[model samples]
Target: MSAAPSRPVCILGLGLIGGSLLRRLSDTGGPAFGYNRSAGTVEAAVADGYDASTDLSAVLERARNDDAIVVLATPFTALEPMITSVRDLAPDCLLTDVVSVKEQVSDLVRRLHPRARYVGGHPMTGTTESGWPATDPALFEGAMWMVATHDDTVADDWLDVAGIALAAGSYVVPAADDAHDRAAAAISHNPHLTAAVTATVGAGESDLALRLAAGSFRDGTRVAGTAPDLQRAMLEANSVALLNTLSETIDRLITARDALREHGDVAVIVDDGHRARRKYERIAGSPPEPITGVRIGDARWQEELRRQAHLARVWMG
Candidate 1:
């Protein structure tokens, strides 16, 4: 009897994130298979020298259990269905995702495929633009990659998974699902929404206001131009964390407003804001220190999760 053929590693969703991953995999000398919701995306991917299709089952049929890695690069709203389809079609293959919200997706994976090997990931970098045309091969280069896996529940080797992320030129950060989600909400999603609000506020101003808009306005509102649907999914999925960050933002604004109203020193307000912003930039710009080699207790892990959860709830509320 002949043995069954192994399926090829298939990347689902050929948008910016998916296309970037496909480009990375192709550079590594492998024929990366791609699946997208749009036929145009699939055709473009095929023309780019990678295998491409919109058929889920057909893509899975070409994947092998060991060599096959399913990367769901879709939006947060499409995650559950995409994951469910992958699980049903590629039961033996390892599953991973590029979704921004890890906690919600992780929970869904755990519930849907209790025994299936899965890893939740979030790449902490992307441009305001999207689609295949917006995809760059170096998109993930020097970026932060968050890998979330439960100790007892996860079966597939995280090292193998981490290797894939490293190959894409990212520094891997091993964190709990919840922690990754909350941190991303604070750093990425919340910032995008705030930038959008800032941009909208300036829209009503005169041409004089536009001319007066210097580097501050440009820098502060850059992310506001990101795709509305993508931004919506990210902010809505992690609303808890986003809200928490928003609250803090509101409080700061209130403080500044009160201080200014009370005839506070303008220099004091500007200096305080500058220092805080600089500190944030420093922390976010730094690389993730390796936390894999060391292991901690269940209590510690639970505590950390609780802390992340609390932050999300507090901010979102």
Candidate 2:
């Protein structure tokens, strides 16, 4: 693993992602603490020997004093209030987020806390679970964590965020905000919607059908078990990209349905899907690419990093 971030971290939200991040940082001896809106969650985290509290002002104050990297791990709908507090209390702190959609979050940061050095991030890993109780310290292990790079992004701020991701055992993929959202919509958001549809159709069938459901059904519908509110928040925040991707998916499905009805064959969709799945498997099973160093303050560093990411390369701290 790369070196832990030099600055302390203050996570503003103690749900699954935030809690797991706190746990992983603590396990790695990184200086980190968290804040949660729920008193119950705060109490549980405190009881478990974590530095957590329900006082938003105090957490942001500490972040300001220590110049900590403040991670906003709240849901999409909850970001405004949290960013408001960060703006009020920690205006100059290095801010980053683990929110699923990057463009929206980056826009919010620019609008609400423009003085803060903000680097948008999204870790491409999770389970069909929610809240502090479902937190797993190793949830991000070997996962792809995206760090957003734009023309105005501060190189050192990006490095700090990437360092945290690397310390958590994740490979850093540097991408622009819009590109991240569009790609995530195709892979993550669209899959969740399809999973929900598949699960609903399966459940609508007879009891015997559900009883006979095995590995394929279970695997396909696994993400459908995520909290509805959470899924809705994420999906709705990336609506434009999700809509485009879903339209493409619907068209493909319609083509398959028509082929099956008219010619009794679905080779077009089936063969394409098989090839895509195999490509994914091949990439997933392949060894990691060698780390390439990029001069952080170079004029074209952002472009270099994005180029490396497009080629499936990672940057280590």
Candidate 3:
């Protein structure tokens, strides 16, 4: 049997996050492959001159090597099944994900794929849009990409996954799985939930609120229009962490309401919010420390999978 090819980066979904990574790889360097459940999505990628496949075997064939990395960009709902599907086929490969919920995925990867090097990742970027057509290769540029890992994971395993994130222009941020999830709950998950509720309330009894809604209303509820399934999956996946954050947000809302009803000072709440907003804007402008060593976008994605699968078949035979 021939030796398996190495360094292949296989993306196992062609949604916004996955497609964006594929585009970035094409520009920056490819041995990058994309797979989507929808054959049409895979064909669309092929038309764009990407290495893509609809078949699981074909996708795995591209990742069947020691140095290969498979990035699962599927919804958190599909993450466990996808992890289970590929666990034994590519034992030595470094398998990671671009899901929002880290603790669950990190825990599952640890339990199900002990032989595979797993790093849970969340790229902190997206619009209210969804799917391949809405994808931008530069989406991750200047964005924070959080990676979650446990103590048992080695340094190289973390670096291998971080490489894919940085090569696409992300600012690499590392955290423990539970910590990452907790932070995500406060910063991302709760905000999205609040946006949805805001939108719902603003829809109002007479539909007048929505009709009269201006930029302030539009801006506030922007994320409420995000793909519902995506929102549901992520919000549900991180419910434990999010519940605490939601309670805090509700408390603040009640405090603001009380100040209005009780004729107490509401300006203080406004001042605090303004201060927080300014701090956020300032932090957004500041650059993070650059991460080194993620330059692996130069290989043909599927060839690596093909070679590995052939090697596997021959060895088994």
Candidate 4:
């Protein structure tokens, strides 16, 4: 079947991710608008000739009328109220999100707005910046934007959600909510924690240590510069997965420490880490396999899409 027509989009937050999305969709001349709680943000977007407002109710009402896809781009802590608004104002809208945590947001939608056709999404892209001023229309370009799939996921809704990601120049990776959370914990969330710790240690050592810090330290601690509240919300929302991943990471560090103390060698940790880094480099440098021939709305569509995602495939549809 052919892909669904690009639907009008209503983004619920106009922060970095949401603002960037608004800019992107507007740049492409697609029907899109956004709501920001901050009037200043609304004014800025308006000044840029984008349709944005501080009125959540009006935005949702418009979405309901237009059958727009409502993207929740707010922080995890802010999701409850934003979702409640979607439930109240646009109960039948197609819902998706860019929040870092998938399972929690999916649960919130299921619990609060069961009537909404929901497909959880998390774009694996961002900088250590927040708000509209930091927004870049090209932020999601060449990024992996996970369009979540589940047993109950509607294929058409999934396609609608993936359409937005594709229009923003992102590759769509279909994944289940729990799988997305677990993988995100390993690659994204845990690394934030480690970056924080690394930055703290380097800063606490001495001014001289920080002064001498170069590319390695800067690259390692880059995400530690992300807003602390944002970091906490992301890490805590996926606390279980983050804890498990953190434990594994801590074990590796302890093992390395012990090996160094006992044998004056850290070869095991070094070699293993080196191999893992090389594997990452190889995969990152390679092009993703394109997924095709899978018909949406088929009985096993979600399963097959997820399988392709696990194999590092991209589905443009």
Backbone clash total for model 3 is 8
Off by over 4 Å in 1: 1-8, 64-67, 153-156, 266-269, 284-317
Q: Write the per-residue lDDT of candidate 2 for residues 1-317, one digit (tens) a residue.
A: 74567999999999999999998898788999999999999998888889999999999999999999999999999999999999999999999999999989988988987787899899999888889888888999999999998877887888899899998899888899999999999999999999999999998998999999999899999999999999999999999999999999999999999999999998999899999999888878897684477787788889988888888777765
The whole-model C-alpha lDDT of candidate 3 against the native structure comes to 0.74
Candidate 3 per-residue lDDT, tens place, 204-294, comes to: 6457766889998899999988999999999899999999999988899899999988986788689988999997787666654332332
Model 3 TM-score is 0.86
Q: How much lDDT does candidate 2 score? A: 0.91
Candidate 4, pairs of clashing residues: none
lDDT (C-alpha) at residue 250 in model 2: 96
Clashing pairs in 2: none
Summed backbone clashes in each candidate are 9, 0, 8, 0
Model 3 stretches astray by more than 4 angstroms: 1-6, 289-317
Q: After superposition, how far is residue 206 of candidate 4 from its true place, in Å?
A: 0.8
Q: How does model 2 score by TM-score?
A: 0.98
Q: Residue 84, candidate 1: how far off, in angstroms? A: 2.0
lDDT for 57 (candidate 1): 78
Select the stronger candidate by lDDT from 1 and 4. Answer: 4
Best candidate according to TM-score? 2
Q: What is the C-alpha lDDT of each candidate?
A: 0.72, 0.91, 0.74, 0.91
